[model samples]
Target: MSVTGPAKPNFAASGRRVFDIEIEALRAVVARIDGDFSRACTLLLATRGRVVCVGMGKSGHVARKIAATFASTGTPAFFVHPGEAAHGDLGMITDADTVLALSNSGETDELLMLLPVLARQGNVLVAMTGRPDSTLAREAAVHLDVSVPAEACPLDLAPTSSTTAALAMGDALAVALLEARGFTAEDFARSHPAGSLGRRLLLHIRDVMHGGDSVPTVPADATLGEALVEMSRKRLGMTAVVDGERHLLGLFTDGDLRRTLDDDGIDVRATPIATLMTKTPRTISEDALAIEAAQLMEAHKINALVVVDGKRRVVGALNIHDLLRARVV
Candidate 1:
């Protein structure tokens, strides 16, 4: 007798099948979008208070993510568990709030139970459900149809397709409201002050550059030796060659020093810095973002930049290390 074992399951094919089902479900939901989406966005945008998103189980998870997206994108919103809302959590909601409820079956008992109270309180109820004729949909102020042809689950019983549709619909609403409100990246940076994008957008060159006397600079008539002394004293890897009026005349960097050293005809102690300094060196405004400075450095394949004003006067200096220290790189 030959020993036999169960065959290996085709996991990749099964996963692909699930993706196909959910993708088709999204397509169906997209086709169903009409004025109701606009209505939902209007209602959300006009809401005087926060958006209170409520659901149960997997729908609740999606609702929480939706709430976070809304809050981060400029809309005031939060998630409230329907079961908890029936308890003292209902106190969190007020008449000014807009209630967004999610239920795949449109018959979640916990969600339905809160409708009467929300209705009595005169709250605007937006229902996202698969069943259009369900009680929740019938009672809502606006109905968002998220019905799918079938669930990705083999038994067609799981919330896979329905939850995906609900999540996408929630994202659609949040983004629409964000655009209508003209939310800007700076505003987003405020909400994410600790994020990389916040550092990139909120941090200006003035904040990180060595300004005033800390900037390494040598008068245009100074010798290469004088510029080298300034570069060493400031430890900025470069020195700005400026005129008597403090106007930037040129720049002498470590690279320039190396090239000068290679030419035996030039002497650091005797050569005028202006003769070897790079005229029209790349410069940046103090108001530019630190990320812009990083980009400027990367684009030019240079390590340091001299900050200058409209008159081409050097105001500050910064190197890649400064950007690295500020976490702006």
Candidate 2:
């Protein structure tokens, strides 16, 4: 007799069960944070050099993310592969640096082989592992136990829950260090000079605003035709109306041109710009952040803003297109 045997387990149901198990494991790891966690933070903070994080396999990926988080949040850190370390990369670890090692079983052969050399070099070792009693944890100055009761894999062989626990522990350590150091968003931006937050915080109006000859401007008494020509020439779609001292009086935009055109019997060349310009147009200081300028443009529902000096004199001009090119939009 041919028998199909037991039906296959529901894959979706199994996935949900695994997720729930990992969640519970993470909660348990979080609950276990106490004096040891504090001690690890203190040790890392006291170090003068970078925090060198090392791991193998899946733990290596988590270590890299942890290093990035620490680096961005005021702590200097980088990842070094354990396998590479044993093969002449060990020179990267200086006596001044602190080493954060990860191994799910707390007994990775590659990592274990380097412990004595690292210890001999007088480097502070902080081990993150599932077994507190393992060789790596016992040899370290501070041990963070990230044990998980079970793996998310149905066969219990994959590094799922254990890896999650390690990642969460790494984040907890980074955040604790961040708070202890009083790191700010501006500090984060300084570390990530290529990111959007960096652009928002570091880019000032002077850096992106069109200035001097590129700025579209016309004297307050100029005819509407002159202002329209200036706007068209500069391609900013707006022109600043300024006095002899360059102090802004009003602004004439395409919107104003449209309104003027709609008015009965209007002559573009004969009309003065001041009579059709929008008085008290939205303006920003030249030293203000680009993000702030973007916010002003967004709130006012306008595409451009006049950059002015402390005396309300127009010095520069900016539009949404400038912001977009600068990645501040």
Per residue, candidate 1 scores C-alpha lDDT tens digits across 1-329 of: 99889999999999999999999999999998899988988999999999999989999999999999999999999999999888899999999999999998899999989988988999999999999999999998899999999999999877899999999999999889889999999999999989999999999999999998999999988998898999999999999998888899899999988988999788779889989999989999999999999999999999999999988889999999999999998
Root-mean-square deviation of candidate 2: 1.7
**What is the lDDT, from 0 to 100, of the residue 263 in candidate 1?**
90
Which pairs of residues have clashing backbones in candidate 1?
A: none
The residue pairs that clash in candidate 2, if any, are: none
* Tens-digit lDDT string for candidate 2 (16-88): 9988999999989998899999999999999899999999999999999999989888889999998999999
**CA RMSD per model (angstroms):** 1.8, 1.7
Cα deviation at 61, candidate 2, in Å, is 2.4
Q: How accurate is candidate 2 locally (lDDT)?
A: 0.93
Best by lDDT: 1
Candidate 2: regions farther than 4 A off = 1-9
- Models 1 onward score TM values of 0.93, 0.95
